[model samples]
Target: MTAVGKQIREAILATGPISIAQYMQLSLTSPVGGYYTHGQVFGRTGDFVTSPEISQMFGEIMAIWYILHWEMMGRPTKTRFVELGPGRGTLMDDMLRAAKRFPQFFATIQGVEFVERSPELRRVQMEKLGCPKESMESVKDKNEPDTPGSAVSERYGGISVRWHTQLEEVSVESDCVPMVMAHEFFDALPIYKFEKGTSGWSEVLVDVDDSTTTPAPPQTTSARLAGSPHSSASDNSSECHFKFVRSRSVTSNAAVILRDPRFDSRFDKGDHVEVSAESARVMAVLADWVSQNNGLALIVDYGQDWTQGDTFRGIRKHKFANPLSQPGSMDLTADVDFSYLRLAAQGKAKCFGPVEQGKFLLDMGIQARLKQLLQATTDKKVQQDLVDCYKRLTDPNSMGRIYKVLAVLPNGAQGMPIPFAPPSKEELNRPKVEKIVRK
Candidate 1:
């Protein structure tokens, strides 16, 4: 067992059971043995790979998208290019490099801020982007940036990057605009899983199973049966095991009552629903910033417009693992509910397509960019690699259909942003090509 696993087991043994949210938070952020707090977790060598790591084109396309929208927003003299969960700073680096074509947009960029909390990942980000000039500053709240002029110089470019632990720490002048990007970010935020009971929905908790000599159910209901679905549950050899059990109330203060009308009395006993208040809270803050200061936030992730069932899973060395089996040795993620995010933006900011990532990238002209790269390259291996990356990004069976993109704009904005504009009346009336599901 991992060190963090022992810590978690001890905590659960002392306290009755811990909510899934608490388990995830502890597993991912525990200062001493948390997964992210200890080591690198991106790219091929890590547990899983992200879009930005798959190809530089991903971030370059986003830069172009930003430029187009910035122009529509009047291209303010000072714009903050902010990114949340910037992994190794690859996306920001590519974005900065591509923004050079539009000198004004690139020059007008005030500061590139990253919202990251992991000290280990922060060092990795600084290595790629640029090391901080001084020790990182601590902020009291989200409204304040640590200190003015606290920036990290980019290794390749002259741009300076600032780091913040929370969205509230990212700040700008009253009149300045902030264009924010969060790629594959929302899924990582801790989520609460609730299962409908005979009484009502209750939060899921992790607990030690002393029911029998056999291994206990990990997550899926099938694991509770005589023939458990989990491979480990078949052993029946362990004296003690860890399993999921429902609890009436959450021990962690992070749990909140989810209020979505669609799910009202929708499930029979034993149905599951996942909620991410952290994701919603972050969106609320970002939406408020855009509505007040005028800018956009692009959120890209692999999720459905609305989600049900158990989407929470874990990854260790790129393969699926039981989420409850190991702590701080892998990544835990759940499918993002884009619809919930759009709901959070209501009244605060105007929301756009929670479109399929494939469709969004295509609409943003990824094919044109791909063709340019193919023509410029001569090595067959390089060409093949590019083709594979493109397919992974756009293939429906892959991220193309599974991943989604959401854009948040200032409320009452005049025109639509690129890749998210509504179709013409005639096109809308025709048989729709189901590339993306919009809310």
Candidate 2:
């Protein structure tokens, strides 16, 4: 019963219940059966492997944390090395091969956008960035031109490269700086699941049951009414049929049953819940284009550190499944709240380390880039598969304690490089059940 669950049960029998972020944006960008628009989900033959496909010492320690945040932003003659969702461009080819050891930060980098919206993964990021269409027209020659019937850009390329489809059409130039980056790009943004029953919250829909239309045999139901009287009906699945309405004055009236009746009535289980309000309004338009241009951002994903509950998930070949078994064919994600990304960088940016991508790649040196790739590969089983990909990227049992690492800057900025050290206030006020009892 998959072909994205028979096209989401014929779009809920031709329109009726759809919004778990519009069924995760048509199940991951629908340009025709979207599970990332048709396959090759990303290396080791797909399904999971990221962290720049797990090595090249994780993009050479994220190009030494973007050359210490481009020398803490002061070395900017022109900067703008963006990257939101640039997959298959292997972390921008290991961040331009670790920014060719600062050939003046690759000649002040000046251009390399790429927000991306799949023209077959933008021709696999223009054949893995052999770059050139005059360096992708030097980011459309820094925007605004075109007056008399514009085609803009007359010339440039002191190193450019563009391609955006969002991040508000990315074409910045004025006071440059804007250095952004994303790795697991905010956990594929799209989540909304609530479950706290009784009669106060019940939003988890995905309806289509007038007898399953002309295609039968996928029937499943549950919604046994009868509320109040200290309500309670926690487990009697058909997915979820909550009824926990207890309020002996009020300390537990919870009622939010949404477990997928497609996307039950959009919202109402304590409202304020959203997944990708276009990824927090494209991270508040990249923190107001790096706080009115003087930039810095760095994401890296797999999230948490916000509060509330539910962190929707799913994946396929590499395991953990049943995100409603096959709708748009698997791979839906969530958990990058980082406190609504620091309230979408509203204080005009200055967030740091949502930390724990194995302590920010072992504080950005990944064990000295894994001993310089085991002293340039001598091969004892290729140094035990690069010491088992650095213990699956710094093992706290894998993907280093559920992956995370955020950064934002643009407030009293100064030549970057301070990798880890900002996560306190008792480590961001502890308790989400101590991060699920420390996972």
Candidate 3:
């Protein structure tokens, strides 16, 4: 077993079976050897590349979107530019660079907030951002009045930077509106898998074995299975035989995993599945924060339209790996159940997009951005590299298809550019597609 696996085994032995959320939380945030805590996980040498790493164009387009929203908000005198999980601050750097195009927009930006837990990463972000020392502040509380230039003295003309461990910790002074963005943040939350069985819906849980190693085990239940038909089956015979089996028989044999079950009630026996209450709770908190603070948030991640399906996945060294292995060393992620997220945000904030990242980027003028980059580059090799990066980011065959984007707006706001239109009934009725669409 790997070092991470050994540590996880020891934990499970001491604490018994842990919730999927707990497992994922430790895997990414543990102080010593967790994925984000131990080493760098970005850039060319990292486990995987994000949109910001792929091309600056991604962040530039996002900045344009933010500018549009700022305009919609009537260009508030003071606007909080916040980013959740600002990894290495590349996205923020690109955003700031792009925002410079609109001097008025930049001028209206009073503070920058980053919701991150890693001190090491905070150091890297500060160094890269060139933010002045006095500008580095933390949010106080909702009750506190706006400090304005207190965090940054009159001498400091640069944007003030604030760090908070959680969204709730960020102080929202009166009269200052907030605009938050999270790129590939929601998908990183842990997901629970559930399978429909003759008995009911059974949850997939990680349990410690006699050897003290934890492995996913299916719990039996009798709840009706949720979600569309399974997309692809590794075992061909199972797919061919599924039609012949009775509903109960099919449910018994079907290995479907529900992403969330916090709101689910009905169930029987022999049902197998999973859920992510923790993810839902996180979204609720975010939505509540935005609504209460007169702010908006945009979430960009890889997920499907709030539809029923399994999209749990893991990555290590840029390759797909078993989530059960190397507990704290690999990245475990799941498709953000936009449907559930939308439900969670209902009545609190306005939700938009949940559209594919491909469509979102295309709509944001990635093609135009590419042309500009091509014109600026003189070397043939360098031009080709830029072209390749553009393709990797916006090509339907690449990140475009699997990854998705969603936006949340403060309730009652208008005039923002619509990222995408809802899919038509015909489109929804089309045959199911595999969750993982690899190049």
Candidate 4:
């Protein structure tokens, strides 16, 4: 058993079976050999690759999108570019390098900010963005009092900035507005899974499998049924294992979530619904920030409009794995509930999109950008790679259909940003073709 795995087992034995959210929180960020605390989690070499690593195009396009929104906000000066979970800082670096073309937009930028929780990734990002080690500023947040990477920093690729441990740390009420980017961020936040049973909705929990004669933990629905019905799994078996049980804990958050209109209430018996209280909290923060500061926030991730349930699964080496099998060895994620995000942001910021990524990029002049790149490079291999990357990013069968974009802006912002606007007649009637960049 892994070190974290054993720690989790002992924790459950000492207290009781833990909630899925608790399990995920410990597995992903527990500091003692947690997944993000100590390993490669991004790129082709890591367990999974993000869109920013896929191609420079993603960030370049995002730079343009930011510029347009900045303009719509009256070209606010001293604005901050904040990225949540900026893996290796690739997207921010790409955006900084690409946005240089727009002198006004690039010049008015006061600083950049990154919200990262991983020490390993934070170092990698600092190195990637050329942020010197001498400019570090340490801060201790009450929420993450023990994390080493929770400090702020100065300068990112020559752009001034700081790293924050939480969103609430960055002051949104400043004279300068914040342009926030959250790519694949929401999916990583822990979600509570509720399974509707005969009695009602019960939270799903991780329990030590009953395999020996030891006493059962508190909050377990029933007594042990194996190896004398009271033995511990650690005593009966050498291998560490766990199982899922229906939660009957008195403090289940299901009742509150179900009652709040922020969540949907259409689950039937035997149905499972996954909700991320943290995600909703972040959305609320974003909405409040944008509304007050006349800021902009762009969220991109692989998700649907509240169409999936029970998607709390694991990924190891780009393939699906049992989420409960290896706690800290794999990446656990659930689909982003964009509809929930929209609902959470309602009455605060003006939310646009939850649109398909393919359409969003296509409408935002990605095709035109691709043409410029293709024409600039004569190196056949480089050109081919670019084309392939473009296809992967924009193709319907790949990230296009699966990934989505949601834009949040102050309700008083002037006009709709590009791509989110209704499609033109010509755009609606274009023929589909591979390897061809559509205008």
Which is the winner by TM-score between candidate 3 and candidate 4? 4
Q: Per-residue CA lDDT of candidate 2, range 1-439, in tens?
A: 5455567667866875554656677778876577886637876566666767767888878777877766755577677677888877777767776787677876777667777766566556655666433323222333323111111122223345667767777867776776788777767876554443445344455554434223211221111001111112221112211111212322211222223332334333343333355576677777777777767778877656654344554555454444554556656776676767777676776777677787788877788778877999887998998888787777865677667777887766654446757456986677543222212
- The TM-score measured for candidate 4 stands at 0.84
Q: Which residues of candidate 3, in runs, are more than 4 Å off?
A: 1-7, 132-157, 209-274, 307-310, 422-425, 428-439
Off by over 4 Å in 4: 138-157, 210-240, 248-251, 261-265, 422-439
Ranking of models by TM-score: 1, 4, 3, 2
Q: What is the per-residue lDDT of model 1 for residues 241-272, given as tens digits with 9 covering 90 to 100?
A: 46888776433342345555555545556667
Model 1's alpha-carbon lDDT is 0.74
**Candidate of highest TM-score:** 1
Clashes of 2: 25
For candidate 3, the 10 contiguous residues with the lowest summed lDDT are 236-245
Predicted candidate 4 versus true structure: per-residue lDDT over 1-439, tens digit per residue:
7777888999999998888888999888887778887647877766677778888999999998988877766777767788999988899889988877887787777777788878677778776777666554444566654333433333333566667788877764378878899998998899888776777778888898756433322211101111111222222212327778887742447888667653345555666677888999999998988788778889998876763455676655555455666578867788788878988898888888778888888877888888999999899998998888887788776678778899998888767777687656884575421121213
True lDDT of residue 27, candidate 2? 72
Query: Stretches of candidate 2 above 4 Å error?
Result: 1-9, 14-22, 25-27, 31-61, 66-94, 102-119, 122-124, 131-184, 187-190, 199-201, 206-304, 308-335, 338-418, 426-439
**Root-mean-square deviation per candidate:** 6.6, 21.5, 9.1, 9.8
1 or 4, greater by TM-score: 1
Candidate 3, residue 232: Cα displacement in angstroms equals 19
* TM-score of decoy 2: 0.32
